[model samples]
Target chain A: MRLRFRQSLDDLKEKLLVMAGMAEQAIQRAIEAYRVRDTSICDLVDRGELAINRLEREIDQMALDLLAMEQPMAIDLRFILAVIKINADLERVGDAARSISDRVRELQAFPVADLPIDIPRMASLAGSMVRKALQAFIEADAQTAETVLSMDDSVDKLNGAAHYTLLTLMKKEPNLTPQALNALMISRSLERVADHATNISEDVIFWVRGADVRHKMGEKPATEKTGTRS
Target chain B: MRLRFRQSLDDLKEKLLVMAGMAEQAIQRAIEAYRVRDTSICDLVDRGELAINRLEREIDQMALDLLAMEQPMAIDLRFILAVIKINADLERVGDAARSISDRVRELQAFPVADLPIDIPRMASLAGSMVRKALQAFIEADAQTAETVLSMDDSVDKLNGAAHYTLLTLMKKEPNLTPQALNALMISRSLERVADHATNISEDVIFWVRGADVRHKMGEKPATEKTGTRS
Candidate 1:
């Protein structure tokens, strides 16, 4: 029974890694769809979303079964719990990709505006954050996860800059409201992707260090609730 | 030992109920702040967020300790797992409240517009959804939880209508872009509050029936993975 449980744990990790790959690819494709204004890439993202959703359910079931049968304790329990939360974050990343694709589809109707927003750059940064966070999870690397936390600030600044730029473009050329809105929405989606990546990294930190570092930044000092061991 | 375990479970339920009250009140005050355009109410929401965050850590620690010490099985284990998820959702609902206040702060800078969007009405509906969902959770009434699911559609429709109206207003009055954007963001925040409520309801359903109804809405049919008993 113990050997079987070990095998199941290994299978769970492998499934999560595959799901992460799909989520990362979907975000890349969604961004490419936005860059080149290709509707076909949007279709691909939609298909990827379906696969991600299916994998999410399967992974969740596997984790729950492990808990039920093995009654995993200590680090094993924490790992399973973290996987559940990371699974949710990855699924939300997929949703972000689909949302970006939806905006791309809307953008297809309008002539591409030469707005001063560097959305491709923002998308690239957010995509790399996702990759790094997932890498941290697979390797249980707290240092990589910590770096992802700092990278989130860059994405936020870029998102704010894009927002201001898009608003200015709308005011300067009121006729471009629809196009500007679509661009603004795409930037917002990328920011959301970045936020999910931050969430994943935080989960990795918690899984590795057993410390809840969430809601700690921009606040006074750290008053962390240390994860107690049994 | 068995009696102590039962008491711990009861304590967990009570703490969650208190936490739910905090989340619901924060949503209500946030909506009221938007309706009255009161920064003071926003401050109250900010304070509520702090308390909610603190309680989240405490409750999570309590739940984790219960899981580690008791190693609960079957329905008891399911209940603890559900509490962890619901606790996370309530914390996110607090975040939605904070985001709404952030928009209100931005809106304070601009003149109020008598736009066609009924944000107060939508906020009221969303607040009620939170209340109903929490009540369902406390009562363990999946029927009430099911009602919360249908209510989500109404909130979604209102959010869509608000988005279109805000965009039209922005185009018609270029000067109103900032104010319109703030209002649009508040509407989106309220919509998120409603989504969190829906998530809580779905969790209640899962806890009661051991069925995962998530991502099952538009699928062929529900293929629930039964909660296997040990």
Candidate 2:
């Protein structure tokens, strides 16, 4: 491997981390907006999305150029491919944050209800998953990625519970129907963020271990199921 | 440029088409189940998901092997990369179908309502998007892919209408809460299917013209916004 190619790879990773930071901040701000009914935070999320989208294109182009020029093989090849996949996930995470913010904007027009759903708690879990998944990607940690995968199930369960709670609330008080549905959509968006994080983690595992772990429910680690190619 | 590599690429594309067929079938079956309140079609969707998942793994492995082994450049590289992205989209399409089927199974337990939601029409539109997107991919037709992108807005509008109508129905008759909510969820799933189709079409355009058309809303075609690399 050439030193210049290694530097380019490092640069790609740095850009991806910057994009991840933007996405994480957007989610945090969106949740903060929801907590305090602050419409300004929603605006912040909307503004951040453009930068994230731009970074996505830059990172994708960089990775593609690396693959095309260097023609990297083995672990280097895997790393570039993983970066491409993670770049897509991070952009979608930003979109999810924007979606949550969209709901917050809608909720601002309606009366705030003391809903039974713990959306803040769900957002916190999802945020943690995003942070952990990015950490796994940075360090190429398969175990951390696996932990992120497990956390996805928890987030999913919370999303289901939130849906049920909102539905019950809407049924009891018809006036709260729109507000409850907005909350439900926000919960779903947060679940999608967690899902994108899980995808990044899966890509990390694939990068480190060269194993396809997706849709293999209850499957063992990459080494046990399919021997590492790297 | 090797004959064997070309044959391998052809084989990968064939597998992708087969997987696309399975995904399309799953969506069709799930919608049929919802329309007739048939639990059996839902069962078939559940069964079809396993095949889709397996095909996803096979396609990913094949694409990765090609990238690593052949190390092809130019259009071959783009084509393989596009296949990988489209493969992921198709699998998600399958998952969306399964989600709709899950809702259908729930609806089967409740009394069916002649709700104002045009879910069947939404499903048809979304299904055609998937088919046309795949056709664009097969032919590398940027025009068809652009058409698929434009159709996404319509599906989104229909999804919004479904949400509005279902919410109104639920508020008017609280007894229809669960059933209406299921219909609402099914509508959302179909919307997601359309989204995945749009993603596939975007990948098609990217592959055909070497232009990143994503996130360039309101922008003209590749020749106008960005010149073609091919």
Best by DockQ: 1
Candidate 2 residue lDDT tens string, A26-135: 99999999999999988999999998988887887777667666456557777887888888888888989998998898887788888889989999999999999999
The ten-residue window of minimal lDDT in model 1 chain B covers B221-230
Model 2, range B80-157, lDDT digits (tens) per residue?
A: 888988988898899899999988876766787888888889999999999999999898899999999999999999
Computed on alpha carbons, the lDDT of every model, listed in order, comes to 0.82, 0.84
RMSD of each: 6.1, 6.1
Please give, as one word, the docking class of candidate 2: acceptable
Per-model TM against the reference: 0.88, 0.90
Clashing residue pairs in candidate 2 are none
List model 1 lDDT by residue over B124-230, tens digit each. Answer: 89989988998998888999999999999999899888888888888889888888877887887788889888988977887877533423424542223223223
Model 2, residue B165: distance off in Å is 1.2
Deviation in Å, model 1, residue B206 alpha carbon:
2.0
Q: Per-residue lDDT tens digits of candidate 1, residues A73-191?
A: 55666788788888888887898899899889988877888778888899899999999999999888999999999999999999999888888777777888888887888898898
Native contacts recovered by model 1: 0.25
What TM-score does chain B alone reach in each candidate, compared with the true chain B?
A: 0.89, 0.90
